[model samples]
Target: MDFKNSTENNEKVDANYNVVPLREAMCKTERRLRRKIDIFVVPTVMLMYLMCFIDRANIGNARLAGFEKDLKLKGYDYNTVLSIFYVGYILFEIPATMCCKIMGPGWFLPLATVGFGACSIATAFVKTRAQVCAVRFLLGIFEAGLMPGCAYYLSRWYRRAEYSFRLGIFFSTVPLSGAFGGLIASGILKLPHLGSLKGWQMIFAIEGIITVAIGLLAFVTMTDRPETARWLTEEQKELAINRVKSERLAQAVLLDRIDATKLKRGFTNPITLATSFIFFLGNVTVLGISFFLPTIIRTIYPSRTTIDQQLLTVPPYIVGALLLLLISGLSWRFDHRQAFIILTGPTVFAGYAIFLATINANIRYAAVFLSASTAFALGVMSNAQVAANVTSDSARNIALGTNAIFGYCGALLATWTYLPWDSPKYMLGNGINLACAATWTIVGIGAAAWMVYDNKKRDERQAAGMEEIVGLSQLEIQDLEFRHPAWRWKL
Candidate 1:
């Protein structure tokens, strides 16, 4: 341990701040800072996410506008383009997160956004299916960093109890993008053939341009952390820093501490891996629905034109977005995460059940509303849990990034699950989603139970003065604060 550095860090706090009760000061500063943080930081990042999701998934809308036919995509090439976004997406999530953490989101996020925006624009110009696939791959690499980066960024600003609502607010933007993208594409697709560009080309070019503009704004507006926030006073900064250091899930005990060893600890930890698989199961429903719902909706309304179908797609996602916000509010108010996640599984199960059992398109359409509402809400609760349970930034990058990879794996499954052969009546696809929901239900139950037991055990250990990691533990594991007996999972 660096005794000198530790003392200096501690004294810096004491020397600058007045002697006041921490709880009183925190309570006072928290209210004010919360408002400021919510206003200044939350909305900015939420906009970035909105732009991110819309651009990433607008290809669904683009497909309707003739992305597939224009390039003469043969065989499974369309699916290849759809699914290939994650090839780069899954590969770079962790590394990009690490970069975002190291470089600060202010610089890194905007840069990544510009990269994806450029890719999105280039996707409009592709001459062949190979070019489409290549640009989509590049788009994935840039967009991969944003989701996990958003999670880690918020972990720095909010405490455990406040996390879900903020996550819900930010993540709600994902489904909202569906509604927004559909509405935008409905109009954008009608642009008179510009030079040689088609409707789908216009969708990519217009949305991509908007995304790039926002990325430029994000560079100027975003703050690195509360302590480093130029908008705050020294006292406010101390209050924020102290509150985090005193927190159970503080990313780093000190602002400057990274502990590269936290990386190895996260990889080796059983609980971290378990949580990720839980994320994998939870993600299957949402990602599956997001990527495929437009196509699924097209089949549901066979009578409608592609533009009409695009217009029709907006309402379900709007409902899902609104419902996600309500659910996230409840989860945050109750301060229990798993119960909400467990409840969502059944909702998804019901939706999938209806699809598999019946031929009624109306009934199946209703099921889409039910499933998307629940699936999108799962991310609101699940993402907060990922942030709350992990110990440090390094560990968070590894664990959350690993979880994202699992998510894309589920997304990969989603692309396959609803094949054209099974379209309109996609019994096999619905059945697989049913199994996914059921597995997530089981995992949610087990994880909730384990958290209860683990929290109890930690309580017992702390009472018995046995908080420390036992003998011969590595330097990395020793630095992991989540291993302490005082740590409690937000069950």
Candidate 2:
């Protein structure tokens, strides 16, 4: 008897014993393996992102720790330093995301993490404003790939429907980092024997060390693809690959190929561009609140000491994190993206407006909570909508990268937009935030209307003897005016 035939017989016996078909058996094995892979994916990605947020926002904590006073920073000096990080961040984000496509996340993401961690640690030693700026710029360069790379990476492991919630779970770390950073800073600032190191310096050192450690763990554990994932069975691997392929085909995207022309089409597409602009405005609100909320809290209660102010920072973030998780769960449960965004935008705007107009400390504190919670939901909607609308992997990658770049650009704007000149009340920043929120509301409504109208047209086309055109893939249907003839602008 032939050895190959004998092995086949054994496989058959195994399947019989398992009471499942060969495909089912393979799928079962794969699921078991994939479970282990998820153990790494969920935790490692969250940890990596947590570090990313902490490193970026540690400067906020630094401001409260006399960092400005020690360095004699004056006249938009700190703002310049903060804004420069985004300059480097924007410069490298697209290129870094493209590199991840070429090099794979297992290598690219961890390497970026290590590079940023090194720069973050080095920040502890920076003596002057210029030196701080240089280190932050370098840190941003290394961190550029994180958001897009992680989004792209998750796209590989999960289906499109599952993407938003996971994205929310991962991105929620941004708000959570605010809370964690505050708590950690509160504790670390009180430590002795650090030898002339300020609390901000300790914050950087400690967070950077944790990042480097996690980067090492990611290197050891990250899987590049289902085929390479050791934990998945051969059957499960095929299903994982085919499911994404089918989704891509439905969206008119070529899974294994990058069409530069189509990628450019995504850039010029009205929906894509509008969404990017929306993201830009959204980040203005996000970063403005993240960086300055503490200062605002301190301003409301000026008599409180530094530690008390630091502790005060935790509540808003805690509120934001909880609200994000709640909204993400609802969004995932209902598969309704646009609806949540439209509803939450007004809340965010109202929150800022209330803060701006109110003088009562209680009402002001309530405004902080409201702003954080509503903003968290709005961010989840923004990220999910962008990812869902773009079809091709390459196009989606580019679109997301561009959105992030512009988002950082908005953040850079916020660095100065929320200035010390308007502090204590931050009249200008509050006004800016209100405008941003209103813009988000309008854009979100337009996009949602378009999605609804376009979906209806898709149904109409299906009814009109266009069976072959029933489910055009995202890339295929993107240029509907030219390709589908019957396609109209949805909104």
What RMSD, rounded to one decimal, does every model reach?
4.6, 6.0
| Candidate 1 global CA lDDT score | 0.77
Q: How well does each candidate superpose onto the true structure, as a TM-score? A: 0.90, 0.87
lDDT of candidate 2 over 45-85, digit per residue (tens): 88898899889888888788888988899978878988899
Q: List the candidate 2 regions with Cα displacement exceeding 4 Å.
A: 1-37, 250-255, 461-491
Q: What is the lDDT of candidate 2?
A: 0.76
The lDDT values for all models are 0.77, 0.76
Q: What local lDDT score does residue 81 receive in model 2, on the 0 to 100 scale?
A: 87
Candidate number of the best lDDT: 1
Residue 241, model 1: lDDT of: 64
